[model samples]
Target: MNTMLGFLLIMKAEIIRGWIITRRYWFRTLTGLIIGYGMLMILIAGFFYSQPAIEKGINQLDDPTRATNYILGFIIGLFAFGVIGMFTQGIQGMAQTGVLEQLCMSPYGLVTNFLARAVVASVTTIFYSALMVYFVVISVGGKLYFDPLPVIVLLTLSFINLLGFGFMVGGLVLVFKQVGQLTIIVRMALFALAIFAREEFLQQGWLVSALMHALPITDASICLKYVLVKGQISETGQFMSVFLHPCFYWLCASCLIWTFIGISLFKIMENYSRYKGTLGIY
Candidate 1:
């Protein structure tokens, strides 16, 4: 009871502090969301708006499955872009402002600092996703078959998944000094792979599933569709798949492991920065 309040207060402080820093670097964050939401909604509009024609055009599966698949594909596309926005902005902010170092000076652990930035970024993401859904409603001209409650749940889980990506990318930034190049390639890959190009994208055949599962983004997409489009949150399979998802949890666990790694890397850089006298200034 009392302990939970204390924890909440501390988390609030961390988020507030991160929020302040965010104002100083507002362009990248704001521009990212704006561009992301704009582009995504346009594509989503195309898909749902075109679905009726697609179903009528093909005599294959009658009505519902065609529409269902269309909606599922849109959900994955949106989530993939969400991942790109999250990791891109996350790594950029850490590398640009050295916020990681600033937060490290505090008594709070790195995990708190890491999570705070995630929350701040999540504020923007939440807005964008809501707007996307609203746009989806406008395009489709209907409400969901079931309550949207399950999607909200899956969205929260997806945020946890994003945390793992943020930390891993931040780690790369710290070690490599500029992972900017890899960011582009990763962005393209996420779009191509998760945007519904393939049916068994992350979990198909043994070999393909093995490869896709190795990347957390893959399972995150699969689980996302299950919970969001299908309203399968109560399913044992969907929930269990989350725990087994490599990119989402296994790597998320690794992020906690890498917090220590970040500390060690920061210590080494601290020494070098002190010798070079560039630690605090830049």
Candidate 2:
């Protein structure tokens, strides 16, 4: 009970710190929002420009539902990028500034500290993603089906899944300290996967399908699309169908498995780095 209380206090402190940082850098935050909006506009313009050629190859952008799918996927990709960045870039920044060792010395330890940070980052990421998605959808005249309950549930699960993946990458960072290129590659892969992953991909073959299900983002993207794009709620206005879906189960299992793997890997790598006396080395 004391451990849980300590964890909660750590979380509260991190949240307060995050709020202060954002508030202190208000101009920077506003600029980021503007930049994000500009980039989103550019992407939409490019999609429109390529619609003709894309139509000939694949009839993907002809309908509102399809457009919503693409937008939602892009938003999810952005969320994933932000969450992962908190681990990759955040750790690197701490290491470079020589604060990494100080954090490791905290009473709560590195794992608890980082987990608290992840929670704060996830909350901010979700807020920003939702804000951006809302404006983009309005600008594009796209209609998305949003049931508050299911959307919140799926988003929470997706956040957990991404957090796990972030921990894995963060573990690598603790040992490597200069995995910028590798992190970029992984981020790009996740971004592309978020945009293209669909339920249909699960029908390819057992091996292929297994691989899709194993990814942290694949089932998440699919589940969100079902709720947001396909309107998968039942006639009784319940999400029982969504709850019963195999992908949903996979998402739950994936969250548990990946989180365990990530935390375990992080602990192993953390110990190895400490043993090598390189935990503070940038």
Candidate 3:
């Protein structure tokens, strides 16, 4: 109980710190949002221009599910990067500014401090991502079926999965100290997976399907689509069908497995870094 309470207090303090930083740098935050929105618009324009057939098909269809799915996938990719960035970019920045060493020496420990930051980052990213999704949906006239319960449940799972993946990357940062290029490549791969992964991929082959299901975002993306875009709820409007789906179970398993692996790997890397006296080296 005391440990949990201490962790909660740490999270609260981190949240307050995050809020202060955002408030102080409101202009920078707003500028980032504007730039992000502009980039998204450019991508949409390029996509439509490059694929005339898809554009025409979207025009002809009343629902435009394909377009909606594309937008959702983009949003998911952004959320994933944002969550993971809290560890990758955040740690790098701290190291460059000579604050990382101080953090390593703190009584709270690196893991506890970083976890608090992750929680705050996730909440902030979700808010901004939701805002962006809303604007994109309105601009494109896209339709989405949003049941609050399932959406929340699926998003929570997705966040947990992403958190674990972030820890894995964070572990690499602890040991490597300079993995910018590699992290970029990995994030790009994850973004591509988010956009294109689907249940149909599972039908290709067992090995291929297993690998896809093992990815952090694949099952989460599919589950989110089922609830938000596909509207695969029961006749009674309950989310039982979603909970009963195989992908849902796969998501649960992925969350457990990835989280355990990520945390364990992070611990190993942290200890090695400490032994090498490079935990705070940029």
Candidate 4:
């Protein structure tokens, strides 16, 4: 089908996006290897490192809450680096390499193209979170037996939520430290939770609690915590809906809104540049 073909093309272009950045830096081969495996090792180590604290909190609790919180904290914590984590350098790399312009000029399927780019990097977040658990097991440490299905579903939901944010930030990169800063801090906070979060972290602080509810991530992260921690298998569908159903549709809507804005801006800038005969000046 034509629709299927379009999807394949989008995936093809996005899968190779990192190579473009590496080529621009003349570090294609070297950086590829580093990003490829170095990222995995760090993810493994982070998960491993955070397990003790997860278990520590678990031990202090009476029964199931201990296991529940540890699992919730551990999984949701890694959410810090989820798809949003790829932006750590992916955003900068794309902008610096002038890929923003290139992306806007695609032949067709702009949303699919951009989503592919976002998903490609989002893999790093998944890597780090899974490794955390793997390393803990290898070290002969306290390990929580998590049901993989829920975690996978939660991870998928979180990644879809971030795809929208990535698109909106594209045009603002020229002068947008505030958004970038906020992103970094949120990433750190989430990663911290992935390691271990206390009730004090989730319940007591008014500011933190407020932010938790307000951020897009709070939806899935909480869903993950509840399903994993509370043993609420029945709530899984609702939690998945809260984040995946509406969030993805919103993300898709955002992509359309953002791409429209981006195109409008480009046209305006192009016309102005043509009048001045300085198109490449930017």
Each model's backbone clash number: 1, 0, 0, 6
Better of 2 and 4 by lDDT: 2
Question: Which residue segments of model 2 deviate by more than 4 Å?
Answer: 51-62, 233-240
lDDT of each: 0.53, 0.83, 0.81, 0.50
Give lDDT tens digits, candidate 1, residues 139-252: 544333444554555556555554555455544454454564576676567555554533245446779866665554555555555444545433444433334434455434
How many angstroms is residue 24 displaced in model 1 relative to the true structure, after the best TM-score fit?
13
Quick one: best lDDT, which candidate? 2
lDDT of 2 at 51: 62
Q: Tell me the spans in candidate 4 whose CA falls farther than 4 Å from its real position.
A: 1-7, 16-79, 124-128, 137-140, 174-182, 193-210, 226-282
Measured with C-alpha atoms, the lDDT of residue 60 in candidate 4 is 45
**What lDDT does model 4 reach?**
0.50
Per-residue accuracy of model 3 over 1-282 as CA lDDT, tens digit each: 654665688789888988898899999999989898888867765665566687575463334677678778888988887777777877788888988888777676677777777887788888988888788777778778878988899999999898888888888888787874478777878887887778888889999999998889999998897877778755467655588888999999999998898888888888898898777788
TM-score of each: 0.61, 0.91, 0.91, 0.55
Locate the minimum summed-lDDT window of 10 residues in model 1: 58-67
Question: Which pairs, if any, clash in model 4?
Answer: 43-128, 47-132, 48-132, 77-193, 77-194, 78-194
